[model samples]
Target chain A: MKQFLNNLALSLVGLFIVGGLWALLSATVSPDLPSPWRTWQESKVYILSPWEKRGEMDQGIGLMTAYSLFRVAKGFFLAILIGTPLGFMLGSSNTFFKMFDPTIQLLRPISPLAWLPLGLVLFRQSEPAALFTIALCSMWPTVINTMTGVRAIPQDYLNVARVLRLSKWRQFTKVWLPATLPYMFTGYRLSLGIAWLVIVAAEMLTGTPGVGGFLWQEYNSLIYSHILLSILTIGIVGFALDRMMGFAETKLRAI
Target chain B: MSFIELKDVSKSYGPRNVLSGVNLTLDEGEFVSIVGASASGKTTLLKAAAGLIPYDKGSITMAGEAVTDFSTKASYIFQNYSLLPWLSAFENVNLAVEAAFPDWPKPMQKEQSEKYLQMVGLGAALLKKPSQLSGGMRQRVSIARAFATEPRVMFLDEPFGALDALTRATLQQELTTLCRSVGRPVTALMITNNVDEAILLSDRILALSRGPGATLSPAVSVNLPRPRGADLLMHDDQAIRVRNHLAEFLLAGSDRERPAQRPEAPAASKDVPVEASI
Candidate 1:
């Protein structure tokens, strides 16, 4: 409890320092930059009534965040479903690794922007295209991490599997899966972070109704304060998502 | 009857040979230990006999069946405990029990696991994971896992080598008791650097020569009576003789100049009767 309070106090102090600096900048050197007070006042409607909808592009901050979260969830789960088995195969089979590793390495660093047009051509719909971009961009982490996890299973544990004469199926389920879980989770966490990041860019390009969409829409409208609000919401949500994954990873390691 | 036999076993890693012309046999219900210095190919020999790794030459057989791979009839206790960190004590043991007796009812498997953990004095720690347990306790869980399978032949590769002297002695005693009390006789093959542990546990002790290519010395019979303890080892003359033979073989093979002093026995053991060991 004391540690938590200490962290909270420190966080508040940090926020205060950054806020004061921003206020000072707006009042002096950058007069066109919105001050903290002005931003808060202008953005209060979104904060106070986060689920409200004024128009097609004017939904409250909560609704926008929820939409972005939904798309990320869909894409992240899709990445997991495909990437996990791919990783398992790559990790366990030398032939599979030799065959696919080069291709995966070649494709891994391609930007979501580069993939978006391809997604659009294949899916022919903005939503699927956005999801395709999000999944493809985020999947590399899960695939790589899972493979590394499988590779990293302690030799003693594998020896135990062999000594017990555990059937291949039992070895996969009991030894391989459990041993790989913590690593797989690390992959999932990274993948989710990537998915969240890709959703913003995907939504920006696709004009979807989400946090990224709201940021783009407000920027086009010259609503500078709302753009700040969207950015803050994205930062806070991404932090929360990461913390949730970290908590899960801790639990897995304890197991 | 010979329960498990390995004749002229040899193994190599790349260009370096680990074991060469290693011949060993364990009679039914016998407990045999191979004592050697570190890196003397003890683990390689144990793994070869258990069929965990393929030997370059020679045949291993259990009950007249040629051993080409790890036999389901055997169980292994590794030096490092090797308990799954994700599993509780009961679960670790239960996993082996389930594999060894797959057709048995789940409740029966659970019962068997609980019984073995309790036998190892881990009834209170049944729910504890390996990380939550101390080194001694984790090894107890590994021992429980090994015995729970009711393996026909047990291979122990320096099972207590990682433990402190006190914990190692305590576990050696517990293992001795467990071996004697189990319902059916189990043929055990163990490897260790500890001469006293071999004296305390085995019916016979063999020495593995220093490696590039290690070979087993002829067996030295550990004819000390059963129900042995660390105290008995000091009190008995035969124990001293066996310890010296094994220790000398080890010291002779190693490059080290001086032997480390053995830990002092408890003062209370001074009053123990010599006849008690006989």
Candidate 2:
């Protein structure tokens, strides 16, 4: 309890320092900049009654956050569904690895934004273009990590499996899956973080009904306070999602 | 018929031969130990006998049946005590029990796992993971796993090689007790570098020349009485004599290249003079 209070006090001091700088800058250097007080007041309008919706482009902060979250979830889920099996095949079979590894290596380093135009052209829709960009960007970490995990399984463990003559299904479930799990979770966490980052950028580009699009729209009208509010929302949500994945990883490790 | 037989067995990796013309035979209910210097292909020979690896040129049979791959009737205990890191001690043993007796009920499996673990003095460590246990304790779990399967043949590759001296002695005595107490006959083929360990545990000891083209020496039968403990071996003049002879043989063979043709069998225990040294 004492440590917690000390930390809280330290956090408050840090916040005050930042607030003081922002207030001074806004007052003296640039009156156009959103003051800390203005940002707080503007953020309250959304935080107090966050579910209200006016129209397609004028939805509440809550609705926009939900939309962005749904897109991230869909893209991340698809990446796992596709990437995990490909990773297993690549890790297990030398022939499969030989065929696919070069292609994966060539493509992995390309930016998600580089795929955005192609996704937009192919899908011919804002939502799907965003999803495609999110999925493509998020999948590489999972594939690479899962492959490494599978390859790292101890030879002794496999020898044990062979000696026991375990059925193929049992071998997969009992040995391969558990052995590969910690690595897979590492991939999952990285993929989720990348997915969240991509979703925001993709949303902005697609001009869809999400937090990124809302921030872009607010910027167009020069509502710096609303833009600041959206930035805070995005950062807090991203941090929460990452923390949730960390919690899940810890739980699985304990098991 | 011999319970386990390896006839003219040879294995090579690329151009280098690890073992060559290694013929061995063991009777039912016999405990045999193969002692060799490091990298002398003792492990390779053990793996071939267990059918874990294919021999380049040879045949291995158990109970008149040609063996290929790993046989379900035989269990192997690795030198490193390869317990899965994620599993508890009980879970590791339970997995083997499940594989060896698929049709047995869960309660029976649990009982058998508990029984063997208790015999190896790991009953208190059932819930501990491999990382939590000491090296000696981990080996005890592996030993329990090997025995719980009740295999007709057990291939142990330096199962006690990693333990400290005190732990090794205690486990060796426990293993002898367990072997004696089992209801059915079991033939154990173990590889070790320790001459005293071989003398204490084996009914007969087979020495190997150093590789890359290793061949077995003629078998030296241990005439020591059963229920033999370290104390008995310490006090017995015959046991000390046997240990010295085996050590001398290993030391003398260290520098010479193994002969291309198989050497003639060395004289058995009866031929060696009681007063002979080195």
Candidate 3:
């Protein structure tokens, strides 16, 4: 608990620094810029009451934030579903590695943005398009990390597993998976963060009913406050998402 | 017929040779230690015997059957602790029994795993993962797992190399007594650089020269009395003499280094030779 608090405290320090810098810079550059205090007040007003503000769909900023988060989560989870196993196969088998490595490498270097149009074309659905883009954006790191982890298993462990005459599937689950989990989780954390990043940019292309579309809508209306507010929401939400992944990684690695 | 035989066992990787023209045999229930200065084909010889790598030349036979046939239930405990990091100590041991003896009943597996854990002083850590265990403790769990499998031929590759001296000695003593039990014997082939350990625990000691190394130097019978200990071997004169001869053979090729060339394997002789340096 003490260690947990220490880590939490450290993270709080980072937030404080970000707040301080933003406040300091905004005061000088744009006097009308959102001060940290004013932004917090505005966040409560906009985010807390997002649902109360009436519209045809009655979409409030809070509802919009929640909806965006839901989509981001769905997309992120989908990426993990697709990427993790690919990483394991590439990591475990030399033949599979040889077959997929070049293609993965080629695709990895191309921007996640480059995936948007291709995803839309392939998925044949705009929401899946955004999700697909995020998944592709994040998978490279997860796959590569997981593969490296699997490949890097110490020879000693392999010999022991072999000696024990563990069945093929048991060896993979008991020996290989556990051994490579830390790396896989590290990959998961990194990829999820990357996926969150791609979703916003991806939403722009697909115009999904989420934060990205919300940002675009506010920008079109020239509601710079809402625009700035959406940007802030993305930042805070992204930061929270990354932190959750980090926590998951630590807990998984310990296991 | 010799229970375990290596017929012209030779191994090479591409152009590089690790072991060439090597033949070795072990009697049933015998404990043989292969010792050499680091990089000797001692490990390769063991690897070939354990079926970890197929020899380029020759065949390995266990209990009159080709080693390929007896590949099942062969347990190898490596120098470095190789406990699956994900499983608790009990799970690691349990998994072994599960793979080998699926018909033995799940309760029986649990009982045997706990028994082995208790044997190795790991009874209290049944639920703890490998990362939570110390180096010595992890190796203990591995050793117990191997023993629990009732392996017909057990290969230990410097299983104590990473432990502190005190822990190494304790395990050595435990392993010695475990293997030497009269009713149900455990046949073991281990590789170690520690001469005292080889002399105390092994029935015979084979010292090899350095690598793409030379031929088997001398295979000596460790004539020491049973239930041996490290301090006892250190004081034994015959042990000292055998230790020196093996040491010279290891040092002899140190200066005359040759880029390793994997040798061709010789025909398997009936006897696993036991030369007494004394």
Candidate 4:
């Protein structure tokens, strides 16, 4: 509890420093870059009435963030569902790894931006296209981490599986799953971060009615304060998502 | 025929020979100990005999059937307590009991696991994972798992080598008692660097020479009374003689300065000679 309070206090101080710097920069150098105080004033109406929706493009920040989060959650879940087994196959079989590893290596470094057009062409719908881009980009971390996790299972544990005469199914549930959980979670955490990152860019490109869309719309209308609010919301939401994953990982490791 | 036999077993890692011309046998009820210094290929020998790994040469058999894989009838206790870290003491034993007797009802498996954990004095620690337990307690969980399976053959690979002296002695006694009280005789083969441990547990103690081409020496029978206490073994003249003989053989193999004494060991122990040693 004490440690949590300390972290909270430090984080508040960090926020203050960033706010002070932004205000100073707005006052002196970048006069059009809305000050933190101005951004708060402009963003307060949406913040206070989180669920309010005036129009399709004028929804409250909460609803916008919720849309973004839902898309990210869907894409991230798809990544895990598909990537985990792919990782297992890659880790366990030399033949499978040899066959697919070069392709995975080639695909891993490509940006979500590069895939966005491909997704649009394939889906012909903004929401699904955005989701496709998010999943395609975010999946690599989980695939790599899960593969590494499977490969990292100790020889002693494998020996135990053999010596105990555990059936193939039993070995998977009793040995493989538990051993790979922490690493799989690490992959999930990273994948979620990437999903959140990709959703913002995807929304900006596709004009989805979410936080990223709000930021892009405000940018066109020259409303810099609301753009700052969108940026802050994205950052805070991403941090919260990472914290949730970290908590889950901690619980798994405690087992 | 012996219950388990390894005839002319040899193993190598690339070009380096770890064990060569190694021969061993265990009768239906015998407890044999292969005493050796560290890196004497004792573990390699034990793993080969247990069918956990393949040997490059010769054949291993269980009741005249060539052993191709880890026998379902055997349980191995590892030196470092290879209990699953995720499982509680009870669960670890229960998993093995479940695997070994798949036809048994869940309640019966649970009962057997509980019985063995309690027998190992881990009744209070049934819920504790291997990470939560001390080294000795972890080893106890391992022992309980091995026994709960009701394996006909037990392969112990330096089972108590990692514990402190006092804990080691106590566990050794508990193991001896557990082995004795089991319903059927469990043929055991243990390998260790501790000569006193071999004398305390084994029906026959065999010395394994130092590698790169390690081979076993003639067997030194431990004829002391059953329930051999550590203190009793320390004072017994026969135990002292056996300990000295085994120690000298081990030291001779490891010593750098002394000319290699090519003792005309029994046919079972004679390897390709020590000419390859640096």
* Regions of candidate 3 where Cα sits further than 4 Å from its true position: A1-45, A56-58, A109-114, A118-125, B234-237, B248-278
Q: Tell the DockQ for candidate 2.
A: 0.58
Candidate 3 vs 4: which has more TM-score: 4
Model 3, span A60-172: residue lDDT tens:
67777776677777877887788889988998789999998999888887776788889889989988888777777877878889889999888767776777777788878
lDDT of 3 by residue, B1-278 (tens): 77789877778878777777777788888898887666667777887787777778878888787776327746788787677777789998999888888899899989988988898889999999888888889899988888887777788898887888899889988887666552575678898877767887888988776667345765888788877766665688888877777666655655344323323433231111212121
TM-score of model number 4: 0.94
All candidates: TM-score? 0.90, 0.90, 0.85, 0.94
Q: Which whole-number lDDT from 0 to 100 does residue B24 have in model 1? A: 89
Over A74-184, each residue of candidate 2 has an lDDT whose tens digit, in order, gives 999998888898888898999999999999999888888789999989999988888888888899989999999999999999988887777888789879989999999
Which pairs clash in model 2? none
DockQ comparison, 2 vs 4, better candidate = 4
lDDT of 4 by residue, B1-278 (tens): 78998899999999889998988889998999998766678899999899988889999999889998999899999999998899889989999999999999999999999999999999999999888999999999999999999999999999999999999989999998999899899999999888888999999999898887898888999899989898876689999899878877776665631235424334444322222110
Local distance difference test, candidate 4: 0.90
Candidate 3 colliding pairs:
A50-A60, A50-A61, B17-B262, B20-B263, B21-B263, B21-B264, B21-B265, B210-B213, B212-B260, B219-B275
lDDT minimum window of 10 residues, candidate 1 chain A: A159-168
Model 2, residue B104: what's the lDDT? 100
Point out the worst 10-residue segment of candidate 4 chain B by lDDT: B269-278
Q: Mark the regions of model 4 whose C-alpha exceeds 4 Å error after superposition.
A: A1-10, B255-278
Q: How close is candidate 2 to the true structure, as a TM-score?
A: 0.90
The 0-to-1 C-alpha lDDT of every candidate, in the order given, reads 0.87, 0.87, 0.77, 0.90
Tell me the docking grade of candidate 1. Answer: medium
